[model samples]
Target: MRTLRKYAGPLSDRRFRLLWAGQGVSTAGDAAMLVALSLALVSSTGSASALGFVLAATAVPRLLLTLVGGVWADRLPRQKVMLAADAVNLVAQVGIGVELLGTVDVGLVAVYAAASGAAAAFFVPASGAIVPSTVAPEHLARANALVALTRQIAMVAGPALATALVVTIGAPWVFFLNAGTFAVSAVTLALLRVPAVAAVRTGFWDELRQGWREFSGRRWFWTNATAHICWNLGRSAYQVLGPLVAVRQLGGELSWGLIAQGAAIGAVGGAVVALHVRPRRPLVVANLALALGAVPLVLLAVAAAPVVIALAAGVMHAGLSVMQVIWQTTVQNHVPEHALSRVLAYDWLGSLALAPLGLALAGPLADRIGLPATLAGAAVLLAGGCLLVLAVPEVRRIGSRPHQDLPTAEE
Candidate 1:
């Protein structure tokens, strides 16, 4: 009962509960939409290159606009920014569904992807920034855990549901469902009674420069961000290649769905573990756990069976979930509330800057070096990058407890 109450504590806040519920639904839909989009492209063109192009199209715009989004998120009401992002996403999803229902026009799909990605630029920073305002300081970690838990659960359900729907009805309806979920999220954002941010008004370029300073000043933060860039770049190999491997070696969409589901299940476990454990050296523990992410990539390299690959994916995702929870909690606790969104925006930018490049290159690389070698290389890059981040003294020394004074960027 104590454990149950501790995990459920965040839900006691009406505002947080609303936010959680809405995000949960929307995340599930997002997961389903990803599966549907990937499969639709693959089925239509039978080319990993095509899928990668569309995915890169989605990522490039987000990468370009994220810093601007972050600056605005801090300047404006976070919830309002989130609502506008949701609205853009809703429209984009509807357009994608309508287009897919008529014909599989890759160009049209890419356009929609760009629109959704642009909206996500604004949404990500605001969403991260808003959490601090929704719950008490003490409940911050637990709240992050709960939010992650719901997202993992959605990931678990979304792929399975998408696979079934894609096999039966079609991928178009999945997009429609995602649109509905965005509407639900918009409504929840509308209802939230969040405290207004008291930001110091400044020039846009100056504000962006300030965010950069905040992000760059922290040795631990930028070090981790560098590793994240490498991590995302390496992980893109799996995202781009996994579906193709499943189609050729394993059964098809079902196998890929199972692997995705396994990862989500593992992430769920990780989130649960995070709800209970507060390691004294949070980043150290997080970096170590993140090393597990390499396992599934290696498994895929060797052409492991679907069930085996799924289990490996589960292990990897569990570590990712733990790392994510720790990272988010630490940032929220330490960063100034007014500057949080901008700092997080820099984090997003640094982390995902190379992801599109990776996605764009994955198919061609696999075509040249072959899938197994590419997977193994990605596995090495991810594991090595994660472990290397631990060499930073600040990442090792930072305590789990909240600090009244923010640490200087330098050691």
Candidate 2:
């Protein structure tokens, strides 16, 4: 019973509950939107290039504006920034749905994608920064775990739901449904009574520079961020090559799907574990856990059986899920409240910056060398990078406590 309460403790806070519920729905909606968009594009244009262009359209604005968005999130009320983002997404999804209902216009879809991406740039940092305001300090880890669980669940179920809905009610309605989910999120944000955070108004560029300084000053943070970049790069190998290998060697799409399901289930389980465990040296533990991500890459490279690869994938993602929860909680606890969003924005940018490059290069690298060799190299790099981050004393020294005496950018 105590264990149950520990897992459920975050929900006791009304604000956290609202935030969690809204994000849960919103995340699932976003996942569904991805499927609906792809189907709509393929059905209309029959051009993979168009699909890729529209997808890139979303990423370009996000990459360009993420830092600016982070600064704004710090300057403004995080909740308000989120609300505005929700509104923008609602409009964009609606536009996409309406257009799909008529004729799928690639240009308009790209425009909507850009708008949504820009909104996400603002929304993500605010969302991460706002969590500390919603839940108690003691419950922060569990809260993060809960949020991670929601995302994992959504990743698994959302696509299935979208696929079903697309077949039944059509892609337009799926977009419309996604719009409604955003509305739900907006209403929740509107209702939230977040504790006021004192805004530090400064020159936008100055604030961005300050954020960079804060991010770079923390040895633990930057080292971990660097590791995360390498981690993402390595993981992209499996993402790009996994399906191809599965089809060629294993059994086809079904095997790939099972592997994905294994990861999702592992992620869910990892979040559950995170809710209960509080490691003293969070970064140390997180790095150790994240090293497990390389297992699947190694297994895939060796031409392991589907079940074996799936199990390795499960272990890998479970570790990732735990690492995510610990990383978020540690950042929230250590970073000063005023600069948290900006710092988080830097983290977000650094973590994702190399992923596209990795995705692009993975296929070429595999072609040049061999699939097994490329996968093995990525696995080694992923595991080695994670373990190497542990050599930073700060990473090993940081504790689970909130508000550690860490230096700020101003210092």
TM-score of 1: 0.87
For model 1, what is the alpha-carbon lDDT of residue 75?
97
lDDT of 2 at 24: 99
lDDT of each: 0.89, 0.91
Candidate 1 Cα errors over 4 Å, as ranges: 38-54, 101-109, 166-171, 237-261, 297-310, 360-377
Which 10 consecutive positions of candidate 1 have the poorest summed lDDT?
Answer: 402-411
- Model 2 stretches astray by more than 4 angstroms: 406-411
**lDDT string, candidate 2, 1-411, tens digits:** 987886899999999999999999999999888987888798888998889999999998898889989999999889999999999999999999999888677898999999999999999999999999999999998999999999988988888998999999999999889999999999999999988888777798888888888898898898899999999999999999999899998889999988998988898888878877799999999999999999999989988999999998999999999999999999999988889999999988976677999999999999999999999999998999999999988889899999884564356
Candidate 1 structure quality by residue, lDDT tens digits, 270-338: 988878768888889888888888888898888899999999888888888998999999888777888
Leading candidate by lDDT: 2
Q: Candidate 2's error at 246, in angstroms?
A: 1.3
The residue-level lDDT of candidate 1 at 222 comes to 85
